[model samples]
Target: MRVFIVHAHHEPTSFNHAMTSEAVAVLTGAGHEVMVSDLYAMGFDPVSDRRNFVTVTDSEKLNQQSEEAYASAHQGYAPDLQAEMDKLAWCDILIFQFPIWWLGFPAILKGWVDRVFAVGRAYGGGRWFDSGVFAGKRAMCSMTVGGPAPVYTDSGVYGSIGSILHPIHRGIFGFTGFTVIEPFVVYDPKRLGDEERLACLARYSERLLVLDSAPTIENPNTADYEGFVLKSVQDKHRGLD
Candidate 1:
């Protein structure tokens, strides 16, 4: 399988790096192709603006969608962004590797999405949800959080882990037509003992190999929605009709 890992942590010796390193070794050892974009090492620009594209749609004003569509048609994206887009297109499975911060992705990782997932490229026109540009591909978040697992449960002060990552799973991966896999979460790795940390790494190795059979989060079909709202018949089952 072709795997593309977007790695976000700044420190090379971090647990996040260990996860990515383990992934590369295991995957490559299995004869799978693996590519990693070390964002901090590469000094990736996270800002989304005209800098994203080499072509201009409107010199007087900035309309990201309009500009992106034009860029998509003319091959006008900046070299860096275009390269990332190429990797997105090349991968069969996409893995976002990062430590969760403030219940979400680190700024650099979030910026990668902002800049790379452009209109007419990632999504635009009628391409979204199940019909999205990358419909058959799969994407997953392999993340580390500073808190205990129980803290992210439904009853915890912080919301459930599912709820916290909903935007990324549904809005980003699902919306772009990539099947969303259940996230591989390592909780408070910094607090874990050496053996425990190694166990987590071993678990991650197993998870990566079985990704095709890995549990996936279900997403509502685009066909069930009209104007992005589910029809009454569909909602009725949930008592939301």
Candidate 2:
């Protein structure tokens, strides 16, 4: 598989960095082509604005989607953004590796998505959900969390981690047409012993080797919906609604 990892951690020595590094090594050793965008190391800009494009669709007013559509047709993305877009297009599998901040992805990674996943390029013109631009590709999040698993459970303070990540899984990955793999979460890595960390890394390596066959989160099929709602109770029961 052609894998692209977008890593978003400021500290080089952090566990998030270690996961990305390990993935590259493991995937490459197994004969997979790999590319990494180390956002922090690259000094990536997280803010989105006119800086995202080389051409202006409307200088009088800033309309992001309008500019993105124009840029998509003309190849007018700023060099940095275009580079990231190219990598995104080239990869069969996309991975976002970072530390979960608060209840979501790091600001840098979120910004990367804002600037990189643009209209016409990533999604637009009725191309979304299962019919999205990246429909055939796969995406997964690999994150290190500050809290333990128990704390993120249904009865815990944070509620279900699945619910917490619904926006990322359903809204971002699924909506963009990528098959969503269940996230790889490392809980409270700072409190883990060296042996435990090694074990976690080994598990991550195992997951990568079987990525092609990994179980994925279910996404709603456009056919199952009537406009935006489910066509029937049966479809909803099947989780497609």
Candidate 3:
């Protein structure tokens, strides 16, 4: 399987970096083709500008042919968007490795989504909101957090980690039509000893190797959601009547 690993951690010696490396090793050793996009290392521009809105025109060619060719060739094609799009298109599985900053993905990763997941590429005018270019693909988040697991659990201070990550799981990956597997989170990195860290790393490595073996959740699209909304509305009206 072609795997695309997008690493968003800034620190070279951080636990997130180590996990990214371990994932790469495991995937590569399993004979899967892996591509790493280190956002910070690559100096990825996260800004989405007006230049992306300008349409490419070839007036010299016939109108229909030019438009068709341009639309076909340039579907979700832009200078800033091409690199990540190419990588996304090339991969069957996408693993996002990062540190959970402020209970979410790092700014760079968020920016990556903002810039790369643009109109005509990730979403568009005529395209269905939930049906993006990445449908049928699989995604997983391998994240490291500073807080303990207990803090993120139900009835804890931070609430459930799964609930905290619902927006990312439902809004981003599920909305874009990728089958999102359960995230693998490592908590309380600062509290771990060297030996414990090593054990954790080994376990993480094993998870990466057999990621496909885990069952994926069903990704509901806009159509599915619309039906639910319509049913709810009908039920409300019937109750009133």
Candidate 4:
């Protein structure tokens, strides 16, 4: 299977980078085609701008839908956006590697998403929403955390990591129509002994080798929500209808 591995950490020697490298080695050794996108190395610009918008004949008067449709039809994506879109199109599976910074992705990585997954490409457009570009694709996130696993557990300091990642797992990937997979996380890197780190490295390698074998989580977008009646009539028919 073709795989796209995106690494978001800036520090080359960071544990996150090491884990990414390990995953790449394992996947490549298994004869899987892997594409690596190191956000920092590429100096990717994450900010969205006016150029992203599709200008209708009279864009000023166009409603949001009209403007969006025009943008989608015109295909005015930036060169960087086009490049990432091409890579995304070529891959069957996507693996994201990053360190948890303040409980989320680093700025550069977030920028990669903001820039690459633009309107028409990731979302927005008439039929595109109903049939998202990423539909049927598989995605997983492998993250490193400075905090201990105990702290992220139910009885621990920070609720479950799964709960913390609901936005990304459900709101983002699910919203885009990709089948989300259980994330792989490494916790308490600062305190891990050499032996523990070695064990984690081995586990990471094993996980990468079997990544394609794991069944993808069903796309949440496939569920029928048309039966539920919203309290407000205007809001009732809104969203994925």
Summarize candidate 3's per-residue lDDT along 59-162 as a digit string, tens digits.
45434333433544556245555778788878888988988889888888988876665544554443442565677678898888889888998998988878
Report lDDT (CA) for all predictions. Answer: 0.93, 0.91, 0.76, 0.74
* Candidate 1 residue-wise lDDT, 49-140, digit = tens: 99999999799999898999999999999999999999999999999999999988999999999999999899988788888999999999
- TM-scores of the candidates in the order shown: 0.94, 0.93, 0.82, 0.83
Q: Give the residue spans of candidate 4 off by over 4 A.
A: 51-69, 125-131, 215-219, 225-241
Candidate 3 deviant stretches above 4 angstroms: 51-76, 124-132, 228-241
RMSD of each: 3.7, 4.5, 5.7, 3.9
Error of 1 at 186 (Å): 0.5
Question: Judged by lDDT relative to the true structure, which candidate is superior, 1 or 2?
Answer: 1
lDDT of 1 at 81: 99
Which residue pairs in candidate 2 have backbone atoms (N, alpha carbon, C) closer than 3 angstroms, thus clashing? none
Ranking by lDDT: 1, 2, 3, 4
Model 1 residue 158 lDDT?
91
* Candidate with better lDDT, 3 vs 4: 3
Off by over 4 Å in 2: 224-226, 229-241
